[model samples]
Target: MQVLTITTPWFSRAQEICAKKKFDQVWIEIVHNDLEETFLEWVASLSPIRIGMITESLTYSSDVHEKEPTLEERKHKVERRLKYMTHALVCDEKDVGYLKTSSRVLAMWWTPAVPKRFIKRQRKLASLPYGIFIGSVYGERSKIIQNPELKELMIHQQSPEHGTPYPFFFDKMHGALYHFLKSRLPGTKLLFLFYLHFLRAIRQRCFSLWLEALQNGCAVICLPHYVKTYTGRVVEGMAAHMPVITPDIPDRPRNRALFEDGVEILLYPENDPIYLANHIRRILSDPGFSQRIVEKACRKINNFHTCEKRVQQILNWVETGEEPVYA
Candidate 1:
């Protein structure tokens, strides 16, 4: 009947769902400092039926120098919290099997709505020479930037407030559009206009930078982590009608079902920058192929992954105590 969620940037999607459902009570605890204590006390007082969001502990299978919490400790935290709640919702599907608790585990994906204004503005400007990377630089991303084959491929790396340091190559090469342009064009005057549009998106907070990239770029390049979790940017790209290229994520059933190779998306094997670059080139060279991919992806997101549909499915499960089947 009521829902309580922690205030985190990632949890905004869950909060939107709560607002749409018009739940009896929606309490959000501001996580300014001491997240654990603030969250624990709020949950104890409210004792809500379904706790929708929580931050996942950072863990690595390999040995690391940092003093990270052990897997058992993280499980204990979940078990402690589950005592007062009927069901726990996690954004990542990998956690569903990792938690291994008695309480019902609802695997929810982050579904961010694409504004109609952005859709209307898409591809209005002349396509730029470069692609865009919106997230942090790490893992496969670091490797992709370093690959020699992709040297001429310009990527505007938009680093978040809390992200790993940019590699030296990226730092050196990233500058004005004219600086990176191998040759000047007759339409060189329009480069500043395109840059201004990018700056406006960041200033106005109209849509995410990646969505803006989908609007301006020839194609969207997403290098997801090796983990099986679904990236919300992929859906945002589809909604913007941009052809997306990313690594294969076959471990999770929901993701495997949602995307098909060369149909809804183009999937490459992990750690293959050569193949990734080739995929990018293919999409750029062939207009008909790119159009087909985006059309299929847009239809899928409209019918299946909209925020309204996701909220209704969650409500159905809460009321009927049965999982809603996904097609």
Candidate 2:
């Protein structure tokens, strides 16, 4: 199938990946309705077989940005895109619950295992016991991640050193790292874009940055999005063999799908920091327990949610056009 991403934002993102390009998944962002017009115009000229990835930050319930499209407008765009797309991917199983289509594929922001060489290199220079938080920081997203305990953690590292990766407190703070790298490295924009785009997966840059932090031996301090979706950064952390401390991010549809709370991952309550601090303390103080959680998380991620496994699932969906039974 021919993909006309030439004029689309995806084309620019495609330039970053160094790995040989085999897959040609298209993105149909809910935020960028203007791209839909361009994409449709291109599709009209050539019958495009659209395999779209729905954006992860789909908080369509309210308009956060002044220019953000309304839910009805977003839905109309999605339906129009669906008219040409063969399949679409969503962050959660019911993520596209409102979209009127049967081609929806339940995919998290899952990623393949990070290259060991990357992890090995990061560990060599890692400052141990640091925790990294990626994703939005203000308003609702902030409320969810920065409870009393997480706040203290962020404050402790408030004066984050140049290479330090945590307290990535705000949603916008993630870009700071990218800019930092771009300025320091000078002529390696493509390399950063490649990894940022790869995110060790292919969806969001924050996940890739978070994975880099994990590779550096920093623990992941996070909670699932309040949008009832599991941000798959947890999967990346687990896959990287790093300990993950999070709130009770539910495993929907199946048991142990996202996590097993205290087994595959350590769980804390958002309201209480004592539990969060204790979990952190346990990770730092006890080596065996930390190792056990990391091992279990890695096993679950490999068995159920790798970038490879997700791609196969999408392929199977494309052929059958039937949503697989959630395992």
lDDT (10s digit) by residue, model 2, range 230-323:
5555666676678777666343443235567778887766545667777877776787887788777766665666555665666677666665
Deviation of model 1 at 20, angstroms? 22
Whole-model lDDT, model 2: 0.52
CA-only RMSD, every prediction? 12.7, 8.4
TM-score against native, each model: 0.67, 0.61
Candidate 1 segments whose C-alpha is farther than 4 A from its true place: 1-34, 37-39, 54-60, 63-80, 100-122, 159-210, 325-327
Global local distance difference test of model 1: 0.56
Compose the digit string of candidate 1's lDDT tens values, residues 135-228: 7676557878878877665474564322433333234423544353534334433543454455454434535544555666667777756335
Error of 2 at 63 (Å): 11
State the lDDT at 289 in candidate 2: 82
